[model samples]
Target: MSDPIAARPAQDRAGIRVICNDHSGRNSREAEAIDLAMKVLGPQAELCHVKGSDITETARAAVRDGYATVVAAGGDGTIMAVASALNGTDCTLGMLPLGTFNFFARGYDIPEDPEGAARVIAAGHAQTIDLGAVNGRLFLNNASIGVYPAILKERETVYRRWGRRRIAAHWSVLKTFWRFRRPLKVEIEVEGQRRRFRTPLVFAARSAFQLEHFGLQGADCIRDGGFSVFVTPDVGRLGLLSDALRLAVKQMRLGEDFELICADRLVIHTKRKRQLVACDGEKFLMDGPLEFTMVRDAFRIFTPPPGDEAAA
Candidate 1:
């Protein structure tokens, strides 16, 4: 609607120290905007550019070098990388999103434009955000195994190279959704209840599109000591049709195609050798029976001019 207030008064800010991942693939528009942001911050900012295979190392170095704010300037993958690196540390996170979907970015109103996001960072308000983990890895968003992970793997490869060409991303999704190899049969236990589901796919979300983008079911309520979860049945034509409808209308209530739940922890098992799984948008191979938990106020992150700083 109306243009959001871009920045807050400088006197209230907690000061600035930024660490950046310049390696992320981004459109030129976003790049130029972020460059301007860096220039605007001037002496208030100290940026660390990533070197080969050293995203974590450089980020940790920034923290060790006394950076009070750590910014993840790339996709969800980059965000997760930085998030995990800074997890449990005092440095607050700031995101300069440059990913295709930017699921978390959109959910939190983190602007896609670097300058817009930077203005928020300059405001210097910080809040603690929850994170979910599978096995021992940390993820800022949802996680899934089975067909969902497979589709995500394909989506990731194309997205990394091409960015968000909606038609192309959809086409790639279509090519894989129909012919996904080996249906995913999963057994999951949540809050001490167990269920066996034999479906073409499975998704365990810690806050995801409730119905394709009507929005996350508990968007406003998450990080308040509880987390929302969802599971998709399968990926056949009917399933595809249902997903399509969800995309079209965003009717996000619990319906036949979806199962919504809330809990502190969950466990899942699969019969696949390397059950493909995604946490946030990062995908990796994992073995059966995993636990996912919500860590309340896990880490502090910077938000916009509304000022995420705790009220004194």
Candidate 2:
């Protein structure tokens, strides 16, 4: 009977805000995107330019100003900040892929053209998706702690210089596999049961696929409130990475038992106090004693239609 979203009270006016990271290397596109949003969203929409120096503060301020829908326009980091700001609030969330490596955008298939994305936003067919919290930081898509996170932190400059594709996520995934010296030792608990395993990386997927060849469409949708746990145990490192890589690229169905696990919540303990975590595309070092739970139908999103649209 009561409305679930945290911040905004139910009201008549559609309070919407566009939060853009103008520095995402796609500034002109961003400007056009905002223009399209203005046309689509009309009088209710407001566009706010956010500086990188204070992403968190600026995003929250927009919500505080009464934005019922806050569209984050940039790469995954900007999404992280904007969504985290709006978490537990009543405001609806939206995405605009103005940055490199729009993994989150891939989840939604947002039009590469900013104007098209604005049209999708204007249509306002809102739906909900699951979210996760790691040491108080929120994640909308996936989180990986271990070699991937390490590589993300390491290759920040490489990504900036060579570009997102220059140090592609899979490339980093491979580089971390071969170069990382830190052997991963983690104790995992899923659905109240405990198990221990050693792995180079542990990725927590909240309702999405890492790759289409892995039957990514069959992969959980984030709003479903489930996690697909990727475990690499006892497999040859190079061969396993290669297999997973091929599976991803080819969009193949992965072997059931060794490569994946599905659960509603997971608790992970590591030997180190802080482990690197790559959530969606934002990298950070998080405290151990990490717990992730699948949140069913937690937050609202706007996506394309099924069949041809979704497949696109």
Candidate 3:
């Protein structure tokens, strides 16, 4: 397929600022990575360390200061935080993927190596892309409620004990499923149609590359400018566990594994006033009647050149 994203004009190198998260999952050598990044980015670019909660404000400040590019040097969560401020603005978003999964960065062909990624930023090639939003918050990949959020909550505990590894993430899923009970009862509204579902998880996906990477369906729908909402059947705990295993091995099937719903906008309501919603690996306690929507051409991001095989 031909690349749908077109590159924008080159940005001013002197106006670049990188906000880095030292606590990212794969950033064990944060000091070394930062030093390498600065050298590759040149003396013109600025780099600073900032906590997660302060990323948005810092990015906004950079924009106000006439920065041409604001790079997020961390995981998807950190990227999303900076995106919240840059979305709809002229400043392009750059990334150094220092996360465990690095799904968002990988999807755009952004390098995981800090110095290599810094070189991409220096090149100043960018493309406009869509982003998913839930109740006004932006997410680069996905957002979910139910079992997925529960898994994230458990994953933190496991990470604390075992450090942040892919194994620990997988382990948390199994542990959460073993103790999981009570499937959520949710009312969903899509395109003026209302439906009810009782399920263990409701996942809303915005990244076609992520779904394709996982061997799941709905990548085309997402590329066509919509979100794919996957609702797991109210299969009992044992059945859910079986499906989880299938997912781990990339052996999951449609219909039996999940019922897919595609829409540009949707609303979900549950009994609880507030629920734990996981967005790109970060958890948020949000109010009910959750709204999920896609914002097309939401922001510009630094990416590999068009027709680059890695981006494809």
TM-score of 1: 0.81
Backbone clashes in model 2: 11
Ranking by lDDT: 3, 2, 1
- Regions of candidate 2 where Cα sits further than 4 Å from its true position: 1-8, 25-39, 166-171, 213-224, 234-248, 251-258, 305-312
C-alpha lDDT (0 to 100) for residue 216 of candidate 1? 40
Model 3 residue pairs with clashes = none
What's the lDDT for residue 303 in model 1?
A: 72
What is each predicted model's overall lDDT from 0 to 1?
0.65, 0.67, 0.84
Runs with alpha carbons beyond 4 Å of true place in candidate 1: 1-25, 51-53, 160-163, 208-212, 215-224, 235-238, 251-253, 305-312
- Quote model 2's TM-score: 0.82
Residue range 129-195, candidate 1, lDDT tens digits: 8777887677776777656666676776776777666655666666566666566677788777888
Q: Per-residue alpha-carbon lDDT of model 2 for 81-161, expressed as tens digits?
A: 887776666677777777766767666777755667766777777777667766667776678876667777656656666
Off by over 4 Å in 3: 1-14, 308-312
In model 1, state the lDDT of residue 236. Answer: 76
